[model samples]
Target: MNLRQFEVFHAIMRTGTVTGAARLLNVTQPSVSTVLKHLEAQLRFRLFNRIGGRLQPTPEAQALLPDIDAVFSRLAAVQRLTQDLAGGRLGTLSVAAAFPIANGYMARAVASFLTGRPGMRMALQSLTTPQVVDRVASREVELGVVHEPVGSTEVDTELLLRSALAAVLPATHPLARLERIPLAALEDHPVITYLPQNLFRFHVDKALAEAGISPRIVAQVTVSLTGIMLARHGAGIALVEPLMLRSLDFPGLVARPLDPPVAFETVLIRPRGTPDSTVLARFVAHLRDVLRAEGLLPEGH
Candidate 1:
């Protein structure tokens, strides 16, 4: 009827006597007898017949034993899985990030995390900044990395890195001769930019506003990689963070630091009151180490 009842029945069937089942279960013989009686009453069938002071299992009990054993086996598996989750050994972490952060830093951090702790699983999704915040708030993602600081008090934010924005242009562009070009100087040229919905676009727009310049947008794309590719093909100059340009081998693209340098901040976000599990903490440390090695973190900070 219940797990305890089934367990008692199973033990009695194996041990062939109530007293032996009691010893196996670390209980009194009377307790085993009570459970066996209750199980047979609940099932409305005789599970055993007494023969020579031993329990001889009936045909019905013999037929039910396999199913009961299977149930207990699955229950044991569930127990083990719960233990593994609690121990931070088995579970899938849902991670959400803004585009380039997902591609650039988070990708490496996740790879390093898996290398250090194999068998841990993760599901990574790339989303816009607002989407990252929404996902964290809705408990869709256990951890989120995004460019914009989440405004909701329900989300805890940790500053990850502030990468300096660079001016990426075709190698033959005339401004390429200069060490760094001012933001206003690019207004007349066709400025290939990240889409307005992207986090990088938010930072770029804010910086341009601060610089008192209105960008003449030529083409807008979703990702930094796309912007760089467009810039390399002479679509227009792109404003992007330094790291985004690092892994690309576009021969025609030259990246120069913005003269009045603008920096974009990356923040790690999570739902407030969610305790930092061992897995998430390890991932945070791995991320910092990766950024530090890349010289993306502020000097001595």
Candidate 2:
């Protein structure tokens, strides 16, 4: 029988009366009777019989009930899944972010957002700004978070926050005693920072150049996490983005503001000409809330 007829049969089996089936299906009693008649015509078997002025299941109907129930069960599951997907409660979220955020704040955001979402799947990637731009431009990922200024015009960008790089040093170090450390004060100290070619490193370099101070560079690393870890190991002072410091507790390390903050913009880069995603927006909200709570992102600005 067709789905409509099957639905009527299933409803009657559930309610045990044609009038009750019509009420359950939100249709008229005549329509429900008509569908059951057609279903019986196609099957060439009576699904119900009149007994004591009420409808009772036939022997054949008793055997068919199990299979029909199973089919309707599957249909209900399918409908539920479609509703969940349309409501943004179930789906795969493919996302990418720059190093510090990917390895740091993004984890907390994803974890908090995914709480109790059993049907949701996540794919998180960590890459440089150039790599993030590539994935966004190719639509390989739904969202990419990066620190500006990225030069790519292929993706639409929105600012997440304005933050800066800071100096992290051993707690016992002399620099840690100061509330803010000046770049020129590093003339004699060993400094660990990003590689010379990195975008964030450019800002630090410019600040140093404008101040005409060339600190002793003992180590050059890729991500801010690396610089923080190196400093934790007595590797002089680390100049790195301090966003992750909120989540990372290095007992031996302490972070201090730079004399002149090396500022940067955290941004969301997404595929151009695409529809907006509720999941992506919710994830971003979780990310910003985490950052704001940690003081990585200032409130209201």
Candidate 3:
């Protein structure tokens, strides 16, 4: 009828004597006997019979065993989940990241975090910067990682990494010989990069404008990895954030810095008023470590 009654009943059913049930339940024999008496009173049925100084279950008790076991089994599961959550070993961690971080640094960090937290589950989504920001603001995701600035009143952003932009060139490209690719030189050849609406694309346009160079825009990509892939296939030189280049090894693509050192930044975001979760904090810490190790994040981030 009640939790303690069910506990006493279960212990008695399993151990077969009041004294044994008392020992199993870590209670006095009289306490177990009193609970059993009260339980039978509430049920209005005899649950056990005393014979030869031992207890044996009656038919009603036998019939109730299956249901009691089911209840206790579910309670055990709930208990385990509580313990796991308290210890930071369970629950789902949802992250929405822009394409570049999702494909490169964030993916590596998630893999590493899962290795240490086998009981934890993850939901990683690849989205555009604005979409990631919206997800964070709407509480659809616990964390967000994006290079483009999409700050809002509902979400707080932290600068995760500031990385220099790099030129992704095919190994056989003539400009690959140069340690630093001049922005003006790109005018002679085609360029593959982010879409015009992207913040990085705006910065690229501004840099080229400042240098008095007009590059031939051959292909516009939604993500840095796609631009890198196009460059690997010899489509054109791709201007990409150095974060992807550090984590990804493209055999046919070589990364070169810009002559004037254009820089891009990645930001970590979470809902402004939401409380910090242990799992989210742990994941953020691990991501920082991974980024720092790969030289995407500065040391001591």
> Highest lDDT, which number?
3
Q: Which digits, one per residue and each the tens of the lDDT, describe model 3 over residues 1-301?
A: 8899989999999999999999998889999999998888888999999998889899999999999999999999999988878766887899989887798878999998898677999999999889999999999999999875675889988888777778998778899999998888888998888888777888888889998988888999877888888888878989877557667787877899998888877788899978778888878888999877876667766
Off by over 4 Å in 3: 1-83, 242-249
Q: Which candidate is the best by TM-score?
A: 2
Models ranked on lDDT:
3, 2, 1
Quantify all predictions' global Cα lDDT against the true fold: 0.82, 0.86, 0.86
TM, every model: 0.65, 0.82, 0.71
- Model 1: lDDT of residue 274: 92
Superposed Cα deviation of residue 295, candidate 3 (Å): 2.1
* lDDT (Cα, tens digit) per residue for candidate 1, span 86-203: 6666656889988777877788878777773456899889887788899999899989988755678879998887767788998799999989899888878888877776656777
Q: Model 2, range 1-301, lDDT digits (tens) per residue?
A: 6778878988898888988999999999999988888888888989899777668999899998899899999999999988877666788899998877887888888887788778889998989889999999999999999988878878999998888889988879988899988878888899999997788888988998987889899999988888889888888789898766766777877889998878888898889878767777667777889888877778874
- For model 1, give the 10-residue run with minimal summed lDDT: 240-249
Residue-level error in angstroms, candidate 2, position 2:
3.1
Model 3 scores a C-alpha lDDT of 0.86
Report RMSD for candidate 3.
4.7
Local lDDT at 33 for model 1: 88
TM-score of model 2 relative to the true fold?
0.82
Number of the candidate with higher TM-score, 1 or 3 = 3
Superposition TM-score, candidate 3 onto the true structure: 0.71
